[model samples]
Target chain A: MNKGLLIVLSGPSGVGKGTVCSVLRKKMPDLVYSVSATTRSPRQGEIDGVNYFFKTREQFQEMMACDALLEHAEYVGNCYGTPRDFVERTLAGGQDVILEIEVQGALKVKEKFPEGVFIFLVPPSLDELKQRITGRGTETQDTINHRMTVAEEEMNLLSHYDYAVVNDEIEAACHRIESIITAEHCKASKYLAELGELPAAIEKA
Target chain B: MNKGLLIVLSGPSGVGKGTVCSVLRKKMPDLVYSVSATTRSPRQGEIDGVNYFFKTREQFQEMMACDALLEHAEYVGNCYGTPRDFVERTLAGGQDVILEIEVQGALKVKEKFPEGVFIFLVPPSLDELKQRITGRGTETQDTINHRMTVAEEEMNLLSHYDYAVVNDEIEAACHRIESIITAEHCKASKYLAELGELPAAIEKA
Candidate 1:
């Protein structure tokens, strides 16, 4: 079986990445979404190993020290990280791995694995993004304002990514992400070794 | 409207490229398949400018001298080339341009337009390719053997291409090509410029 490609997708909040990824997973069965390992307490309905690999702070630190984490970051006094073993295992099994990480984590993964295709999802417009954030009604006006400021900072890092899909529509963004994954698999380096092993009889003739 | 992307696709003979490209073009109305300019006489039912530019030797040479041809080659005492003007115009008009040229021409276009996506289509296996060629029944056994030899040479250059798709199935191959094109447009360089120019009032606040 053909080995799978590693895809890293990053975007600001309110870009509908979760929705797009869910739909894409349904469309592509071979895709394995990498569940992160976090030190935070699991919320209700969040399953261990399925939602995230809930780990103790010491365990997370040990993984980080041992270089077992692809990327890790601290948020609100809790640590979140991606374990390298699961991703490698998935790829070894011929399953494509998707890491729906933040920009900082995405950059770290790119630094470690240059072959990983990094894609940033963008909102259609700042106004549209602000509208989406405000429409959520979960955050206070100050929190919404803080997110808008963070979005600008993320947009500044757009140049570092391989591709940027505008979240104008969830379907279109998913399609773009799916396409990048498919195209990356078609790179020549992956097939050259197999092609080189063509039967000697065929080669000689 | 954003300018369209330039895509160049090349593959060994008997890879079902024609069928795949036809399906892709039909599915994407905005895609324009570039027609070549050739000194060779048109066969039956071939129309000028549609099938080929049908240029005289002198006209072809003039194009070559003026550096108006993106890529050109001579075969069997006839000269064939891609007209740069038409392709540029089509791209400027916001229509993605698809150049289904030979490997050499594809390389030339890549050198001329570094941003152009280069896709190399490959068959599943040499034996399958030979079978397909023989199944066509249009070529003699000797011709088929010669073509197979040529296919090996073409495969050697696959490393230079950005993507290598296996033409095991026409529909899948077309889908892959279409996806590559869509993904290419999402490159950060293309969209970041527009995003950068958002009104300063919105950006600063």
Candidate 2:
């Protein structure tokens, strides 16, 4: 069996990455979602190893010290990280893994796992992104302005990704993401082992 | 608007490239089929500039001298070449162009146009490819052996391609090809112009 792919998905704040990912999971049920490890206390309804692997700061620091985490960062006073063991086990069992992360975390994953397929999700347009952010209705103007500035910075990081999916419509974006995954499997590098066996196989035939 | 893509499709004979391409053209009507310029006389019902742009030996040589053809080769004592002008114009008009050529001609085209997306069509397996070749009925055992040897060589060239579409089922293969085209359009390199305008567009908004 072929080894599963390691996919890193990143986008700006209001690009609706979570919704796209949810629909994509429905389409590709076999996909493995990487649950993060965080030092922050779990809120109501959050389960250990389901929503997140809640850890104390010392435990999170221990994983980092041992080089057990794939990528990690401190955010809003909480330490969050992706565990390497679960990802490797899932891939070794021929199941693809997707890490939906912030741009900084995604870039850090890229540095550690260059072989992973990096995808950037974008809104249909900047105007659409602003509308989505505004549609949430819970944010103050100050928070909205800060998010727009951050979105601009993230959009500039498109060059770092291998593929981009524009979330004009949820279904269309999911389809593109699925296509990218299928196409990535068909890359020549993925078949090197089988291709190498061809000459001998032909001689026998 | 984004510029169109230059796509090269190649596979061993009997891999059903022509069939898949015909089906693809039906689905993607805007796709431009590249017509080769040939010194060989057009067979009955083959129209000039449609089947091929028939050219005299002198005209063909002039194109070669001027480097107007993207790739050319002498085959079965007839000169054949892809005209660069037609392809460029179609792409500039935002229409994707598909070039169906043999492996040798494809590698030659790659040298001149590395930006082109190269796709290899394949049978599900080597045994299946051999079966397809033998099923062609017109060839003797010796002729079949020669073709099989050549097929193996071409399959080894899979590394030269960006994507591989297995013709196990025509519709599935076509769908994959279509997906690849859509996904390719979303690549960052294809959207640099639009991306460059994002900051200003956001500032104005």
Candidate 3:
């Protein structure tokens, strides 16, 4: 059986990546969301292995040393990473996995798994992004401004993505992503590995 | 607007490329079917330009010399070729064009237009293919055997295609091709050329 796709949805903060992911999950119930393993203590209601694979500092480092994580990063005093074993197992089982992560983390994942389909979700425009960010009453002017700068930098890295979807509307973006997934499956490279093992024998027959 | 996609449908002679294309046309009414220019004398009710470009031998040679033909071949002392202008014009106008041709001609078209989306349609199996050819009921045993040999050779070239869709059922095959088209549009390379110019200026903003 063909392995499922590792679709990485990456974008800057407040670009609505989470909303898009949530919508996508509803649209595609079979899609598995990747759970990260982190050394950071879980907040209230966060479950180990579900919310995250709660790991000790030593355990996280060991995973890193063994190359057991697809991508890992240290934030503040805690380490966070996606477990490679779970992803590989799920994909091998022919179930697609959606990995929603920051732009930086997504690039790291690409280095480890170049075959992964990288999608960079962008807002329709800088002004729209600012508006969306500002719509959040919690953010102060400085925080919003800081995010705008970061978003611009992230947009510059758009060239690295397999597809750059404009998050103009949630449903539209999700539809486009679905089409992209369908197309990816149709791509020759997706099935060539399986076919590569058969052509010689089949031709002889 | 982004330029249109050049979708090339190819496969073995009896694999029902024409049937799939016909169904696809009804489904996607906007898809332009490429018309070949042929030097053969027009048969009854074969309208010029509508059915074929109806070129003379001298005109066909000029097209070949100028690289104006995407792919050209001679059979039974008559020449036939796909005009490069019609395909290019249709694509540049942001309208997708579908080229239904033999596996050999599709490969030739790829040599000229590397960006063309080459799809190979195949029967479910060799036995299925033989059954389909025999169902035509017009060929003698020798002709059927010869065609089977030729088809097997063509199937060997399957690796060259960007996508290989099984023609188990006409509707199912059409659906697969439609999904492939949707995915091709979502590909990053499709829009990167237009996006390339913007990142520099947008980054400065």
Best by DockQ: 1
C-alpha RMSD of each candidate structure in angstroms:
3.0, 3.1, 3.5
Lowest summed lDDT over 10 consecutive residues: which window, candidate 1 chain A?
A193-202
Q: Show where candidate 2 strays beyond 4 Å.
A: A39-51, A54-59, A76-78, A138-142, B38-68, B75-79, B138-143, B201-205
TM-score of each: 0.88, 0.88, 0.85
Can you rank all candidates by DockQ, best first?
1, 2, 3
lDDT of 2 by residue, A2-116 (tens): 7899988889878998778878989999899998898988866678997688999999999999999989987545787999999989988899999887787899999978989
User: A1-205 in candidate 3: lDDT tens per residue?
Assistant: 7789999998777789878998999999999999888898886777897667899999999999999988987643568789889899999999999998778779999997899999989787787888898996666798888888888888778889988888999999998888777777777666566566546646544
TM-score of 3: 0.85
- Model 3 gets an lDDT of 0.84
- List, residue by residue over B87-172, the lDDT tens digit for candidate 2: 98998888899988777778899998898999999888778888988996766898788777778888888888888888999999
In the range B1-205, model 1's lDDT, one tens digit per residue, is 6677898888887777666777888998778999989898986777998868999999999999999998998743578799999999998888899988777778888888988888999887778888988997877788888888877787777888888888988888888888888888888888766456545534663
DockQ-superior candidate, 1 or 2: 1
> Recovered native contacts in candidate 3, as a fraction?
0.50
Give a tens-digit lDDT track for model 1, residues A122-159: 88777887898898777778888887877777777778
As a whole number from 0 to 100, the lDDT of residue B162 in candidate 2 is 89
Residue A14, candidate 2: how far off, in angstroms?
2.2
Candidate 3 iRMS, in Å? 2.3
